[model samples]
Target: MFPLFAARWDRSDLTASLTLFTGLMALAFCLVHLFVGQLRFLDRNPRSRWLSFSGGVAVAYVFLHMLPELGANAGAFHRATGLDEVMAESAVYLLALFGVAAFYGTERALKRSRGQDKDQIEQARPESSVFWLHIAVSSLLMFVIGYLLNHREDTSLIGLALYFFAMILHFVTADFGTRGDHPELYDDRGRWILSAATLAGWLLGTQLSVPEIAIGGLFAFVSGAIVLVVLKEELPEERKSFFLPFAGGTLLYAALVLSEQALSA
Candidate 1:
């Protein structure tokens, strides 16, 4: 028999291991933002199948895992916030709606600032103030994701692994999308700031603990934002995205996630 495997687990050892693992995952996220633009294969004009596949994986994660978890956490939100029954039931979802609307509005603002004409919009960079505003919003989102890595609803090893994988693919798509919008600004300044924001969030998570309701709210908002980002990237006409890889990635990750839930159940 394996004595160590049968031995009782120590709480301190488990905590230390989790901390080390999540910290490494956080670093991986930072690296992805910093270098994703350099992935020339994904920079194809016709849109790479890999890019579509990554979007599929991200979308699958949001719809399959995060949204359902938000519903399950509704009671926690009610108890923590002391809201009315109706408000408690709808609060998380309302927050999700707000997230989607906010990002959509920001995109519209950036486009309008570029110019009214399509050709002018394509060639002109967003105004300096607009570009910085976009970066600010994106950095805030990156911070939320990094903080959640340490304080996820499911802190089990497998849960963290699933979250990390989904978010990495999501980041690839997000970074690429931003680069398409502001190639020079994103490369010179935006990526570095976003990368730093993620690390800063991880650093804060190590130092602070918040109410579970607040964490759940952040998670829900992120889920909504992710849906918008994925759809916007994959649905555009010019991207010429492939459908087969997208569907394949979706089915593959969905099966894995559902199987994990069943085993844990």
Candidate 2:
């Protein structure tokens, strides 16, 4: 449902409502998967299933929640000021999708490069430098996208940047720590970078005044860090197994949803 132009942007109540709706939808999606585990049918492999379910929820949010709101708001905005919402909204979605695709693509590439056959690698490798590279590329893409949006004068660009950077850095840090071949010296460096990234995210989010997105980003960062820490201790033998990657995928999905919220906000 779209709102009508009233000759000026009123921050359409409908847009605001949609933002809240999408946020709730994202939270619900995560909680339901965490608790009910109904989507296990989507994939036979447990880890793959988790990644798919999480990714599915994120994709749904984009199509069902974010895109709809953009269409509605864009319609109203265009009617009132002769601006094109379709192109703007499309750009946002394209950038978001590109980030996700890049992460997955890079991950797949890494798995292949590691002498892993497609099926075996999916179950075997958990944490790898290639995987972390995927995260870094995806994160960097978010920053680029944010810069583009800001250059275009998108009001929510700053919030979007904060949200994307937080999650991206979280993944990057986790990946860095989990790399099986990482030099011991790099561990401390990785941790320091992660700490700085988290602090920077917090400060940026605060300065930008997007509390909701900030909280979401922090949640992702904390969750990722906890996963990496636990994995470092528990899976010493199979440090490169599917466990960590699965968790990373979940975090990436969270980041996507948060980015959507920030952009829409």
Model 1: per-residue Cα lDDT over 1-265, one tens digit each: 4332233323323466667888999899988888988798997778899999998898899888888888877888889889876787699898888778877877788889888987577667788788788888889889998887777767666667778888999899888888778888888999999999999998887777788788878888887788888888899886799999899889988998887676566
Expressed as tens digits, the lDDT of each residue in 17-100 for candidate 2 is: 324433342333223212232333422322343333333333333343334443444443445445477764454344445444
For candidate 1, give the lDDT.
0.82
lDDT of every predicted structure (CA atoms): 0.82, 0.38
Model 2, global lDDT:
0.38
Q: Model 2 compared with the native: what TM-score? A: 0.37
Poorest lDDT segment (10 consecutive residues) of candidate 1: 3-12
Error of 1 at 70 (Å): 1.1
Looking at candidate 2, what is the lDDT of residue 113?
62
